[model samples]
Target: MSRFYEIDPTPENYWRAIILFGRNTASYKFALAKALLELHGNGKSQVKLEELAVPYAKHLAQHIKQQPKQITSKRSSFLEQITAYNQGQLDHDGLIQQTTRLGFNNVIDAFHKVHGNDVGSRFFIDQRRSHGGIELTDNLNHLLEQLSAEDLAGEVEARWRLVEEAWANNLSRQLMLVEYEEHDQQLIGIHSQRRISLTSARPALNGYQKGRCFYCYREISILYGSDTPADVDHFFPHKLKRCDDGKPIDGVANLVLACTDCNRGAQGKFDQIPALPLLERLHTRNEYLISSHHPLRETLIAQTGASREKRQDYLQDAYNCATVFTGSWQKWQPRAEGVAVF
Candidate 1:
């Protein structure tokens, strides 16, 4: 069994729990929390319900704008509301009114539930006053102090690292990969408005891998209209361990360039763990991504954990889980010899 199965439910781990196991709506709550934290700074400041709504709405708008065209109806409605407000179709009063009608108050309510009622409730203290809206405990404020303002992405990555470390130190009966897949799906859904295509990050990935298939490490083409154009493969097969909502892990950490043959020929390997070599290659490729200063680096860190030691532990845990489910693990080899491991 992987050590990740035995993570203790500590306060710090509760933060990780919220990231990896919180409800889908928790994404909005997290964004709002971060925005509030930024606004609150190092003092014990209390923001009014109306004051919080402005930044929360702005944050949600930014999130919606970054998404692909296919979003939930609720998000689409909110998007429309924000668009009208931005276009001056709605004034400040109108915007606030629309926000109430659009169900943002529900998001706020959900945020409090996650922080107060969830298993990781120890991480936060929520005081709902009859008049002053909500008050955050000093404990929550102190915890936020340790986080960086690099962005919500960075804050999530940092918390994930903490969870990874906890798992590495203890072995439990439950698998962390299951929770990870759940979390990954929610994240993909939140950002699903944008699809990742071959043309999106191919240039950077091709250069980083020196034009080789990330898995097979076989020389591949990057040019358009080539007989053997590169295929974008999910490092973690999407078909296996698919989410209950039918969403697959389409995040940057799971995607990589592959040769046509390597991709199509690898059928029946869906959701199964790749050989140790592929796992090692994925780790190295992620390092390359980080070194290149690619935005995907943040995704990789969030999904795989931060630090080199934590990354290794995460892969091992994933491998252990896959092996248990499939009964055996298969190693992927290069079709031809002398293919370098990039």
Candidate 2:
């Protein structure tokens, strides 16, 4: 069973699992995703590959112009043609022809696979055999109704940017160190003293949290201008920054998304150490983040410890020190009916 679907079983969460956990050897998946979102339900159940080529090629072309290395490979005939099109060697018509022929070769097959296993829901069915194109599934339609296409598109964009930036900089494994800047609440990538400001910590994290508040497990929106925006909360209060002995208290490992009610409401966890159970939950959440791809995985591993046992000790020690400084800690009691989404 797909763990992501087990979390919420909603079409939106399934789509997010594809975006957050699917492998990215190239940016083709993302480009194809943007194309699908652009063309999904505009009065058509299916789109011919040639028709799909237009937006597919356009998105890839735009990204090629912005960032050159769209694929991990040094050479891809598909990308080469796109580059030629960008350089004026290939005209728009010729570009579309090449995209029709070369694109959709792998992405269509791999889009629904997360970590090599099929997701529980099908967003689109491959119909190239019978229809010479792809057919939009009811799952896609349902997801569109649940969340605006614009919001989903933004998520694809955010995930794409993070992947491409990390690839462009060759930041893999421990080479990349990410730090949290509390002032702007954005993650910063540090390597060789050069700091690269990455995406907002909210969207980068909300998917992993499955769009629910960490404390209450209530559904939360990562959207910036939404009526009730989720807060990028520090699990161990920010003031306890001094207790970690030099480890960054603002690191990604300690950050969790909290709904406004659980964050600043009358029962908010303002400056108090979370109850013991919440600490264990934080450990589980951090491990989940570590299992994910580069930058975040590396960042958390760096901030916490290299091994699981060490990580457990690190959090426990930090929690212990936090309890001491606070003098007396209150156990945060979440509402009785709150669900544990993670």
lDDT of 2: 0.82
Q: Between which residue pairs do clashes occur in model 1?
A: 5-172, 6-172, 67-193, 67-194, 68-193, 68-194
Candidate 1 C-alpha lDDT tens digits along 278-329 = 7887777666554421234455666677897887786666656556655654
Q: Ten-residue segment with the worst summed lDDT in candidate 1?
A: 171-180
Poorest stretch of ten by lDDT in candidate 2: 328-337
C-alpha TM-scores of all predictions = 0.43, 0.89
Clashes of 1: 6
Q: Which candidate's TM-score is highest?
A: 2
List, residue by residue over 25-110, the lDDT tens digit for candidate 2.
89998888888889975768889999999999998898889888888888899999999999999999999999999988999999
